[model samples]
Target: MTPLRPPRSPLGRRFGHLVGAYGLVALTVLLFLAFSLALPDTFPTLDNVSAVLSNHSVPAVLALGVTLPIATGKFDLSIGYGLGLAHVVTMQLIVAEGWLWPVTCLVVLLGGAVAGTVNGLVVAYARIDSFIATLGTGSVMYAFTGWITDGARIVPGPHGLPAAFTDLYDSRFLGLPVPALYVLALTAVLWVLLERLPLGRYLYVIGSNPRAAELVGIPTRRYVVRAFTGSGLVVGIAGVLLAAQQQIGNPSVGMDYLLPAFVGALLGSTAIRPGRANAPGTLVAVTVLAVGLAGIGQLGAQFWVTPLFNGSTLLIAVGLAGYAARRQLQRRRAQPSRPVPEPPGTAS
Candidate 1:
C-alpha cells in the first residue's frame, strides 16, 4: 500500500495555505507604503508609528485575553463591561475609600476574577451557551459600572495617584512607550504558557473535542474556568492602564474598545496557526489593525472608516476561518480508509 500524502508541492503548499494566513499582514504593509507615498512627510514617520503602538497597547492586551476562551470555543463578551466596572472599582477604592494604589489594583483584579468565575460556572457547569451567559453577565457588569459612577466620570485623586502607578502608561523604556513594552512582555509570557505547557495541550484538546478530552481524563471544566479567569484578570489590568492613561474613568470608555479587540482576536486566528487562536497570531492581528487604521487615518479617510474597516475585516476573518475548517474536514473525509489485509496463509 502507498503511503498517504498531503497534496501540493512544498512551495505550493507554503504559498496556498500561508497566503490567507498572512494576507492581512501583507495588506497592512502595502497600505503603509501607499499612505507613506501619498502623505510623504506625515504618514510614515517614527513618531506616528510610536503613537499608534502606544495607543493600541490596551486593546492589544484585551484582544490577547480573549484568545484563550476562543481557543476553547467560547466568547467573553463581558470583557468590555468588566473593564468598565474594574476601572470604576479601582477609582472608588482609591479616591472614595482612601486605599493605596497597590491595594486598589489588587482589589480590582480580584473583582475581575470573581466575575469571570461566575461566567465560567454558568458556561461549564450549567452548560449554558457562552454567548448568552457572557451577554447577561456583561449587562450586570455595565449596570454595576453605572451605579458606581452615578452616571458620571471618576477623575484622578486630589494628589492624583502615585507617579509609579501612572507611569505604567506614561513612561518610556528603551525609547519605546511603556505600554508597548507591557504588551510585548505579556505576549511573551502567554506564548510560553500556551505553546509549551501541559495546560496548553489540555486546552487544545478541549477546544478540539470536549468529549475526547473528558474521555482521556482531562478536567475540561477546570481548564475552561481557568481560561475565563485568566481572561478577566487581563481585562482588569487593561482597565487599570486605561485609567492611568486617561487620568479619568468614564463608564463609556470601554465599549469603544470591544469591537476592535474582537476584530484583533478573530483576525489573529486566521494567521500563526491558521485555524487556531494562538498568542502570536493575536499579536500579529493587532499589529495589522493598528497599522491599517493608522495608515487610513493618515490618508484623511473619514473617521468612521476605522470602525468600518474593523467590521469588514471581522466578517472576512469569520468566513476565512469557516472555509479553513471546512477544508480540513474535507481533507479528512477524502483520505481513503485502509482495508484490513487478508490473513497470511489463510486463502479464501
Candidate 2:
C-alpha cells in the first residue's frame, strides 16, 4: 500500500502566507544589491546610508503620519502645505519675534493641530470629500506660507539656537545617524499603536466600514478626527525637524517631500498586510524608496528620474493593493455556505 500523505499543518500554511505577503522586502533587497554592484564604493558606503536616512527622515515621518488618516479611509493633502507653513511659523517665531526655540516649536505644533482639526471638520461635519477638503485647506495653507515668507526663504542665525536643538538633526547615536534613530523610534511607537492598541483596532474597523463601526458604537467621528489631528501633530514635528536640518524655511521645500510621502504610504498598502496601510509597512516602503533613490542619485541619474520612479511605484502599488482587495472579497464571497459532508453515516 502507498504511504499515507500527511496533511500540512496550519502553522506552515500561515508561515507561507506571511512570507508571500512580504515579498516586496525581498525585491527591495535585490534592488539595493543591484545598485550597490553598479555604484560600487559610492552607493554602499556608510556615509551614503547616513545621508539617505537624514534626507528621508522628514518624509518618512510624514508618511507614517499620513498612514493614520489613510487607514481611517481619509486623505490629508494638506500635510505638505502644513509643513511649509509650520516651518515658516517656527522660523519667524525664533528669528523675527525672538521667541525661544522650544516655545516656537510648541506653538507651531499647535498650529498644525488646528489645521488638522479644520480638515476633520470639513470632512466630518461639512460633508465634504476628504480629497476636496484637504485640497482646499492645502491651498489656503500654501497661500499663508507665501504671505508669511513673501515667497523668500527665512534663514536664521545659529546664535540664539541651542546646540541640542540643532543636534536633533546633526548628532549621531550608537554609530548611526540621529534622524535614522528618530525614524526607527517613531516606527516602533506607531507599529505598537496600530498593531496592539484598541484604538488601532477601532481605526481599522472604521476604515474597513465606517457605518458598521458607528452602528457598533465605536465613535467613528471622534476617532477619524483624532487620526487627522494626530497626523497634523506629526507633520508639525517634522516641520520643526526640517527647519533644524536645513537652517532655513523655504516655501518651496515642503511640496518636494509630498510625492515621496504619498508614494511611501501607498506602496506600504501593497506589502505587509497586502491592502492595509500599516506602520511597519510604511517603514519598509520608505526604506525601499530611500535606498532606490539614493542609489540612483549616486549613479548621477537625472533629477527627473526620482519623480518618475516614485510615480511608477505609486501606480504599481495602488494597482496591487486593489487587486489584492478584490481577491479577498472574491474569496469571502466564494467561501462554502455549508459544511462539507462527512463520510456516509457520520453524525447528522
Candidate 3:
C-alpha cells in the first residue's frame, strides 16, 4: 500500500502526502492496466468495460447511499431491505397495478424518504442504537418485500416493460452507460454537499464530535436524521435503477449488494480523505472492487468467489477504517500546538 516514496524536502513532503491521500485512484489505474494486460483478449474491450459499468452502477449507487449515514457516525443497515422493497414495489405498481412508470418511481422515492425518516426518528428520538434500529427496520422491510411479491418474481407483461422505462437504464449517453452517469452526477452532488456545503459540514462535525458540535450550536440530532434520510433516498434511487435495469423483481436480490456497498463505503474512508467518508473516495473504492471482481471473474473464478472477495474486503475495510481514524487522531495530537493569547485586561 506504500506505493509512494517519502521525500525530505517541504514541497516533496506535501506532494508525497497528496499522493498517499489519493493512492486509491492510482490503484484503480494500476488494476485496470493489470487486468487489461493479463486478459488481453477480453478485459481491454469496450464491451467489457461497458458491461462492467452497467452492472456495477447500481451497487455504486448503493455504496454512495450508505456513505451518507456513515458520515453522521450512524449505520443504516436497512438500506438493502429498503432497496428490495423499492424494487418490488416499483414492479408491482407497474406490472400488477398498471400504474405508469413515472408515477411508480415517484411514489417509490417518496416511500424511501418515509422509510428513512422512520430510521432517523428511531435512532435520534428513541435512543436506539443505529445498528440495531436499522437492522430491525431492514428486516421489516424484507418481510414487506416478500409480502408484496409473495416471494415470487415480478415479471413484466407480454409486451415487456415500457421501452421508455427500460431506457432509464438501457440507454446510452454519448456511447457511455447512463447508470454510470448517474453515479458521476450523484458523486458530484455529494462531493459538493459534504465537502463544500454548510449542511455537510454540520454532519461531519457531528460525526467527529457530537458534544462539541452541539455546544457550537449545530443541531446534531436533526443532521443525523437528515443523514439517514439522504441515505434512504439514495437507496430508493438505486432500487428504481435496479428495477429498470433488471426488469424483474427478485425478492432476495437486495442482500447480495449489502456487503459490497458497506465494503465500498468503509474501504473508501481510508482513501482520498483518509478517516472521513467521501464521495470521490467511495467511487474510487467501488472502482477498485469492480475492476478486481471483473478481472477475477474473467479469469474463471467460481460463483462463491464474489462473496468471498466482498467479505474479505469488508473485514479489511473495517480494520483499515479503524486504523485510519486512530492515525488521524495521533497526527492531530502530534501537531505543534499554537500559543493562545491572554485576555487584554488580564494581560495588562
CA lDDT of each prediction against the hidden true structure? 0.83, 0.84, 0.90
Off by over 4 Å in 2: 1-16, 158-161, 328-348
Q: Per-residue lDDT for 1-348 in model 1, tens only? A: 999886779799778777867776777788788878988898788888789989999899999888889888899998988888888787777767778889888888887888888888889999999999999999999998998889999877578877877897989988999999989988888888788877767786688778977776777898899899888889988888887787777888888888888888888887767776778888888998898888788778997888899899889878876676667556646778433223223455
1 or 3: which has the higher TM-score?
3
What is every candidate's alpha-carbon RMSD to the true fold?
6.9, 7.6, 5.5
- Residues 1-348 of candidate 2 have per-residue lDDT tens digits of 999978669898687567647877987899889998998888878888888899999999999989999988899999999988888888888788888788888998898888888888888778799999999999999999999999998877757456667887999999898988888898888888888877777887778778877766677777788888988988998999988888777987888888889989978877787677888888989999999888888788998998899899888878876776665556557676432223223355
| lDDT by residue for model 3 (1-348), tens | 768855369887678667757888898999999999999999999999999999999999999999998988899899889999999999999999999999999999989988998999999989899999999999999999999989899999799999999999999999999999999999999999999877777777778778877776677788888898888899999999999999999999998889899999999998898888889999999999999999999999999998999999999999988888877776767788433222123333
lDDT-based ranking, best first?
3, 2, 1
lDDT of 1 at 173: 87
What lDDT would candidate 1 get against the real structure? Answer: 0.83
Give the Å shift of residue 132 in candidate 2: 0.3
Candidate 2 global CA lDDT score: 0.84
Q: What is the Cα-based lDDT of residue 136 in candidate 2?
A: 97
Count clashes in each candidate, considering only residues at least 3 apart in sequence or on different chains.
0, 0, 0
Clashes of 1: 0
